[model samples]
Target: MSCYDTNIYKVARLKAGKTQEGAAEALGISVESLKAYESYSRLPPAGVVDRMCVIYDALYLAYQHNRIASGDVKVIPEIEVLDLPRASIRLINRVIQFAEKRRDRELLTIAEDGVISPEERPLYEEIVAELDGLIQAAMELKVAEAKEL
Candidate 1:
């Protein structure tokens, strides 16, 4: 089954600090509509799902994990969401490690000079570009899979 078949909306709503009435109002959607999505009685519009990501990627990921754990969702490796608990865990971990090290080094540099020098800026820019590719790959994969479903 697709995660669209699961309680991901409800779970994500809660993870996003729920406040359904307020959130629904803010999103310019009726409370009933939000409730329907959470109950799995209605498929959220693509725009709503996209907006939800802005609120909580971790929660959405957790929802994906739940769907996979239930033995109902098959992850198409190349098109998978970043299923961090699976083999993708290694890649995700590497990204996190890379980011942490980059942050530490950048902080150390800034601590010394109180500003990024032109030379140091290029190093940070390099890290940013590399991370952007890795992050975009996962995001594009998610979008691709969603389109397929």
Candidate 2:
């Protein structure tokens, strides 16, 4: 019953102007199955999620699904749904802030040699967090663009 599962699946469906029965038919699953997924009682398979992404014209749904399916591994960054203009602005801002902060120089310094020393750990963590922010911003922009298509 994670918020990611309930919120994104149901929200995306509704935002796409799809009723439960219609979305179920479009997804080629029973209404009960869709209900289970929407309620977070069961997670949908990746393949089903992929189809839903396309059918509902909501690509962010795929991103959310991948994030949820990753469990504790958490390779996917969390993202917010934004309008195209805001998404673009946020991504550009992230890139600008990263560059202005000399994150690349710091990261290069940290990675110049084979290993990260204990003293460099904090800086390395900061760089990694900034990179994650960049990734999340880019993903948000991508989702916004996808909605336009």
Candidate 3:
């Protein structure tokens, strides 16, 4: 994504009601450095990112950072700040949906032979996608809880 499209650092700082000078001071970096990070001209180090999460009270920044760093790899799932009750309900619904699909049985069957044949590839991918969804829901709930803290 282009810097214009993904100026999350600036957005998070702004959402936290911080000015550029204040955020820069709190982050222990120069205003230009903070601006670089916000503009995506330079990526902040992991440590700075962590401090930003706390300083800005934006835990989602961690997820955003990982997503940005991983790029197309998508090691991190896209998540949103949800209310506690909504997050809980969403997580429960995902669990129920996964269980209803009975993907566990299919996964066991696929793994029983210790190989994924061409015919099984599509099913395997579907199951993995469902599993990733479950993970994402759980992470969303966790983030919601953390935000409540």
Best by TM-score: 3
lDDT of each: 0.60, 0.87, 0.88
TM-score for candidate 1, please give it: 0.41
Error of 1 at 19 (Å): 1.5
- Lowest lDDT block of 10, candidate 3: 1-10
Candidate 2: pairs in clash: none
Q: In model 1, how large is the Cα lDDT of residue 138?
A: 64
| Tens-digit lDDT track of model 3 for 70-138 | 879865778766888998999899889988989899999999999999999999999999888888888
Q: Could you give the C-alpha RMSD of every candidate to the true structure, in order shown?
A: 13.6, 2.4, 2.4
**Per-residue lDDT tens digits of candidate 1, residues 1-149?**
54456577666667678688876876678999988877767767767766665655433443353444456443422224444344255446657877777765765765596777877887777666656556655654455444344
Q: Quick one: RMSD of model 3?
A: 2.4
Clash pairs (backbone) in predicted model 3: none
